[model samples]
Target chain A: MDKLPVNHMQLDRLVLDWMAEVRTYILKEIQRPIIVNTKSNMRDLVTNLDQNVEKIYIEKIKQYDPNAQILSEEGFGDEITDLTGPVWIIDPIDGTMNFIKQRDEYASMLAYFYDGQAQGAWIMDVVKNEIVHGGPFQKVWLNQNLMEPPVERSLEQSLLSFSGIHLLYDHFQYQTMARAALGYRVYGSAGISFIRLLKGQLGGFTSVLKPWDFAAGLILCQALGLQVKTLDGQTVNVLSSNVILAAQSLVATDIKMLTNTSSNL
Target chain B: MDKLPVNHMQLDRLVLDWMAEVRTYILKEIQRPIIVNTKSNMRDLVTNLDQNVEKIYIEKIKQYDPNAQILSEEGFGDEITDLTGPVWIIDPIDGTMNFIKQRDEYASMLAYFYDGQAQGAWIMDVVKNEIVHGGPFQKVWLNQNLMEPPVERSLEQSLLSFSGIHLLYDHFQYQTMARAALGYRVYGSAGISFIRLLKGQLGGFTSVLKPWDFAAGLILCQALGLQVKTLDGQTVNVLSSNVILAAQSLVATDIKMLTNTSSNL
Candidate 1:
């Protein structure tokens, strides 16, 4: 396979077209009976739809650029150990629990990474029919409108979305962070929560998330000038479970202070 | 005014008609600049839209039935100490903070009571344009389709939504309940959260809510045979702030076991 030079406009069109196809396919399939399967635990869920959607993306990405590697939630993509070349990271259905139960709040996330650098990203909120896509080189687009960069807010001036279990256990001093922020919420889906954060509807979001869970959101956050990093301010490793604290820069700093002061990390 | 007889069909039509008008009025008002104001606290919000919408409801109800009384969030309606005669309970905009910030997750909630008995109830999720309305006699409708009674689940099998402050402070021992249930969530609006419960998308919801917050929600729960009460199993008073646990009977029973064992009321 030849090394294909990246073309921003062409990449946008191609990825959007693929996502549109995935959306139509899922919309039809969801109305029928969805075969649900449990993964990791009884509460951790996956559906046949997740597998089928990943298959579709894998086929398209391979055809679009044969040399491009793929890392995906389901095991339908490449087994590359290094980010030494063009790569596609995909979460076919980012909120499988919501998808299997409420049939809402789920999203399809896809992002392009090359030699450890994010190239582009897209998130299609399946139920709301909202698409947010962009990259570091492009302004983020929410549906058809270019999203204005969100106003930065102090930690005390923002609503924070957090994981319930983390707060209950006081992990990373989450309890203190909750009290210090304006208010707290938990919507049960990282993709939906990400949308709320990008819209400035939230101060920040802290959760233990997988690479696919943060892949597209991370790219979009970078494009919009929001901070994305490990809760401890370490660099994000794109292949493992990462404790992410994505927020406006000021809130991120405040949250870091709380976590740093906590006896337990 | 003159001891109006409870007419299920007529009330449904009138309430639906009024709701349609309310929806149109809000859709227009939302597009213009929204004027926000602080209520009891900075987080407890009210908007110009809330007052305007409540005013519209008050005017229409008065014109429709000259003698009917109203107890509303905005002081545009009468203040009655008791739920006697035809009384309309209205929360012009539930989740006003959401309406002001996110522009989603807010709802217009209305319920009718006569001689302290629920006659009809309606909740419109303004942004989603979905209405759930019915009464003790008529079947509940989400848009046009009648909602099937939600399947009952055991506490271990359901998702529970709780107010963040309640859980953080262990109000009602919500932390114990949080650990006892499958998991916990918070959408920040009682109406939106109630929709999830009625659909069986959630196992239960526990919060300290005002009359307007639970009026329509209480009626819908009764219509669907779900349990509505204080965590201590006291009857809900619809004229004041009260602690509420709205859930499937089996789940409610399970949650009661946890609450009963807690030292805090």
Candidate 2:
């Protein structure tokens, strides 16, 4: 594959513009009824809107950079056995179940990375018409104006969003822990819940999410100066599944310890 | 206490007006910084806004009925060990953790019943500024417009919302039954989740919630034409704490089967 020579700025701008296009596709498809397919029992799902949304972006990406590698949920992208070179990791719709069911909490997520380094990312909440974006500028934006990191608070005093399954199945000892607040919450939308984390509503959050799910969210959190990593405190593999993501450096520390008991860090 | 004639029409208007007032209160409070206090370890919360919001409604109720009984979360209402006449059940901030942290997904809930006969109920979604009122109408408004129930899918084809500690800890074997869906979901708020159930996003829902937490929602579901009852297939109690609630009528059969093995149901 031949490499393109656009700097991060040009690429970021194109990605932002591309996000708007994807948002249009999302809104159009969302109002109509969706076709749902099961992936793993009822816990996993694939919607027609997911495929339609991803294909729309991939077609446009090909027009923008014919040589660009695409990692998409719909299998329209590259072979992508590994993450290498200018790959556009697209979830199109990060919270598919929420999209298929509620149509409100779901988000359209897009992440662009070069040589495994995320150059820019976006999580567009379609119903709300807000795209949370982040890049080298170290800012998160709804559109134009920048967003601040969440209100400073401790996990013990803040609301936490965790996959109730993980909290139950993972044996994190969270059940016995003193951290459960009266406000302990769960949104079930990784992107929307992550946005809430950045907005200062949740002190921290944890969930078994996919790469396309966390890609845009990671950039948004990093831009807001919060800590994010896999449950084991390892750098997230943008190609894998079952990753747990969180906010607040403090909350991340406790989460890392709880989820990965072997890690003394 | 002197028993006076119950004015159904007047109380309906009062319930509607009081709900509107609390909706405004929620909007104003959302903008202010939240002060979250920890309760029941760090997971449960009791925010200043929670208490304040409850206080406002308590005072209003007192003025309206003068002799009407009240049960509220913030200790601002009343105390009676038994079901009484024309009592008002209120959960000022039904999703307090969401209110304290997310500033969205929370509701100001109130249910009025005359000696246990359901009369009126309100669930005002704060951020959307939409009132899901069903006492007088068959339609549920998302904002200014009416909302149709989510596509009429079967339980196996729906997305669920049940995230109480009991789902995993107490071993909710019925998980296999609800898991028959396109996905299994959990939210932090029983009140908020039940309203979503009314939206038909989930084919059914089950949650262990308090009386105040579900009284208004129970009345709302009844008004919206959704099947709602305690998990045991009994009508809900307006005064006693309810351990389980499901919106779909079919769910009643399966969930009851799951809990029948244990006397817990």
Candidate 3:
């Protein structure tokens, strides 16, 4: 060890430990009765719990690394209009509606960007306490253990999850896409829904999602060595919302089938 | 008492006990490692688990209620060429791909229809073991307890789930509907995915699902006081695929958004 500068192993441990703290806080918050409040409709929701959880994370980050810049959903952190230096991109609670109602299909997403590129991303399944996480050069982990490769599900054998609108509107010819694939589903929660893509359950799905909605998952997919791209197969811009996003390689093969089917509709 | 009807209290208990047994058998199958086989494109999938689970339920139903007919996905049961009598519509695994791949979003669904009208429905979250079920009456249950009334999760405030293809292709104008809802989620499992709708966690949803797919959920939603209809807000054909399905009083509100926001394409 003559040329060792800093211990990379220790840094990894610290990140894992920090993630544990985040998980605990989230679980505690969930255990408490959710105080749901609607934003625009009974469906557009923002619970006090969502705000509280973000506040807790902000406080924790300040103590652990005051120098780290933050971008949060609830506007509880510093203005991070730019992704520079060691920036923490946090969603605090990804599926607010699920958090308020069903208590499942919710996630806590966090991503780190260093020098404007993703360094690591973690998406915690709050109900299960398992994390779909990725770092540079690593297979995704469900909870510290490497997950098995996504099941080799085929389009006819595959099951997909995406917005109901995507299919009903055939905005990207998804209805035709459905005919080529095995099956389809719609959940209202985006952050928590795409686990199938990362795990290789869904062939592919399309969504009009914002940066906060896609950021952590996008990074996690990249880390897992899966293709994460716009529906047109272009790179995702963290600053701009993609018209569509999908799981890579296998799912993409069905695009022709999708387009062919939807055009007639 | 002047007259007595064969102790309904006892009959209810007997039915509950029978359901409990079915639930246990279902759980055993769900827990077992699935046997995934491929077809179509890389996105399609099928599993030995789906066939096995369906077989177990059909056998049990025969042993318990031998004369009842069944409409099932797997060929283990008789072909449901028509819906003329008391038929048990069963989807052994609603989210087969999820079962084979994600192991999370799949569900075991059962519905009984008498003369093309629902008598009872059961939608069980196999992964979580929570069954949100009931029928005929305007009430639903999870396990032993009566479920709380559905919160007013409106389309704008609600999280809606649908097949992503529908929206992408503008099939029945799903994209506009989604823009009106709180958000969207696409899961691979239909029987399992619709649990929220019955429980009142979701405002509503729609998909091109077969009778077995919507049978149980339709009954359960009716009991929960929701409006279930085709995508065009028409009373759906119970024996065929329904283009849309969702809550009752909210139907007009939901459909208006879809039709208004929809483009001719």
Q: RMSD for each model, in Å, please?
A: 2.8, 4.5, 5.3
Question: What is candidate 1's lDDT per residue for A59-90, written digit by digit as tens?
Answer: 99999889999999988888868888898999
lDDT of 3 by residue, A72-175 (tens): 77778787667766677778777676777677778777776776867667777777776777665444676767876564545666656665545555567655
Please tell me the TM-score of chain B in candidate 3 relative to the true structure's chain B. Answer: 0.84
| Per-model DockQ | 0.66, 0.41, 0.35
Model 1 docking tier (incorrect/acceptable/medium/high): medium
Off by over 4 Å in 1: A1-4, A261-265, B1-6, B261-265
| lDDT scores in order | 0.87, 0.70, 0.68
Score candidate 2 by TM-score against the native. Answer: 0.85
Instruction: Give the winner by TM-score: 1 or 3.
Output: 1
What does the interface RMSD come to for each candidate? 1.2, 3.6, 4.3
lDDT tens digits, residue span B1-265, model 1 = 3254866877788888888889899988888999888888878878889999999999998997899999999888997899778899999999876777677888999999988988889999888988889877787888788898898889988889898888887777888888887678878899998988888889899899999999999999889888899878999989989999999999999887776767655
Sort by DockQ, top down from the best: 1, 2, 3
Model 3 chain B lowest lDDT segment of ten: B2-11
Tens digits of lDDT, candidate 2, A1-265: 2244446556666777887777777777667777888786656778887888888889888898787898887677887776577778788787776776677787888887777776778887777877778764535776777888766775556667766555545445555332443345545678887877877777776777777778777877887888777756777766888556577887666555654554344
Pick the lDDT winner.
1
TM-scores, in order shown? 0.95, 0.85, 0.76
Instruction: Highest DockQ: give the candidate number.
Output: 1
lDDT computed for candidate 1: 0.87
TM-score of 3: 0.76
- Sliding window of 10 residues with minimal summed lDDT for model 1 chain B: B1-10
